[model samples]
Target: MTSQAADRPEQVASRRSKLTREREQEFFDAVLDQIRECGYDAVTMDGVAASTRCSKSTLYRQWKTKPQFVAAALRSNRCPRFAGIDTGSLAEDLREAARAAGGTSDKDQGLLQALGHAVMQDRELQQALREALVDPEINALRDILRRGVERGEVPADHPALEYIPAQMYGVLRARPVIEGEYADSDYLVRFVEAAVLPVLGLT
Candidate 1:
């Protein structure tokens, strides 16, 4: 026989009565802001409820747990850095992407850093982070590379293509850790022009 718990609906539809799309976004924003300021381990359901002016039961009914709630927030809050970017030239496209990524707000970086430890420990959070932060940018970068190949600007099977995303993203995150400096637009653009373009022979 199917267990009642197993058969239960994903969310309590009746208890979810109070939430609207706008209101739900507010809750998500509140939770993310708190996480950025307090770190994931320090944020509490009560704190979220109080700050959002919603009852704790509402959050519990919606997400069932803190990790789930945070994961949802992360996925919902993603601001895709690369979308609808094509500048005809691969070099310009990459420079544009660098500018966009390097323009990420300190708040965004803080939230990422705050979740770093928890993401490693929680599979769901890790998935949410990748879905939110990694996949879109990688897909966009791949599109840029593919377009270059089609234009005869780069080789179809260039080995560096596979590692381009990793290199750019790694350096962006690593700069702050290693040098206490956010990878600003100028720096990222220069890095791309110097390191990336030269590698692909697009320089």
Candidate 2:
């Protein structure tokens, strides 16, 4: 067999010998906290190694580059905020979604802001951020809207339907920048009731 094929078993064995899930989550948590504190460009593998008390080589073996490491950490940290909301009313579903989004930790928002510049420059980081932070939420929001359409609460051809995710997420991400406060659950629910539901004739 070729050298690469011959090495596959040993590689898999070595990977299987890596840190347990709990230990790896510790590493990921350290990485995210470091990124929040230091910004993406400033966080180093050595810093993560020192903070998490793991050998730098261990990190390098698991993720060869800093971008890859950060991406993996971002993916690991994802918590789907918009899952399993079946309130049977679009307005209520959205309000519940807003409440969930607002309840998310400040560290999440901070990490996205911290990595914003770096993500623009690295395709992998951007993909990771979208996969971890963006896609699941967007998909869930779409599901909510789809359910609304099925229930005849909103028309599928409504122009505003396409922009619901953007509108909600944009405000969620922008509120801290513009207003100097995280958009908490109350604010989000109010916003949805006032701005979003009315537009769809739910109000």
Candidate 3:
């Protein structure tokens, strides 16, 4: 067999090995839903297989371990929810971001709480969680702040800029603990209008 003939079979095999996007999304959704319904410790590849009606070996073949599988699922669900949020005013930008974050706060917060202990125990899981959920919002918030500075709305040396991400994300996690409520869109928008904007000297 010539080199091109030998390569054809390998390429065909590689193509066959990959799952379609819709199928992969189904798996990701199934695993995350399981994690939400059952705690991270209670979730398993076998459970996901049963839930999705696939062979356990199929999941094991794609991801060697539970953590790896969960991490991949988390990553697959990643969306830059806070990206492309320029509204010509930092205050408005932040309010928009708050609304955006709050829209999924219940589900995302529940997932985070479910995975909290496990994530603390696994560095890969922690990083994956941050990549999937945390970093994108932080990066987008930073972009909003950077734009504010550029527009002279806020000084570049303002101390509050450093803590904006913490403040924004903190409330989403803290409200359930403090007030026994999930920070929904209305609540988050109110938070931005009341607590966040004032601290930054914006209306």
| Candidate lDDT (C-alpha), each | 0.87, 0.90, 0.91
Q: By lDDT, rank the candidates, best first.
A: 3, 2, 1
Q: Considering only N, C-alpha and C atoms within 3 Å, which residue pairs clash in candidate 3?
A: none
Instruction: Give the residue spans of candidate 1 off by over 4 A.
Output: 1-18
- Which digits, one per residue and each the tens of the lDDT, describe model 3 over residues 1-203? 88667787658657656778898888899989988899899998889899889899988878889999899999998897789999999999999999899899999999998997999999999999999999988888899999999999999999899999889989999999899989999999998999989989999
Better of 1 and 3 by TM-score: 3
Clashes of 3: 0
Per-residue lDDT of candidate 1, residues 24-130 (tens digit): 99999998988888899999999999998878998998899999999999899777787877999998899999999888835666778989799999999999998
lDDT comparing candidate 3 with the true structure: 0.91
- In model 2, the runs with Cα more than 4 Å from the true position are 1-16
Off by over 4 Å in 3: 1-16
TM-score of 2: 0.91
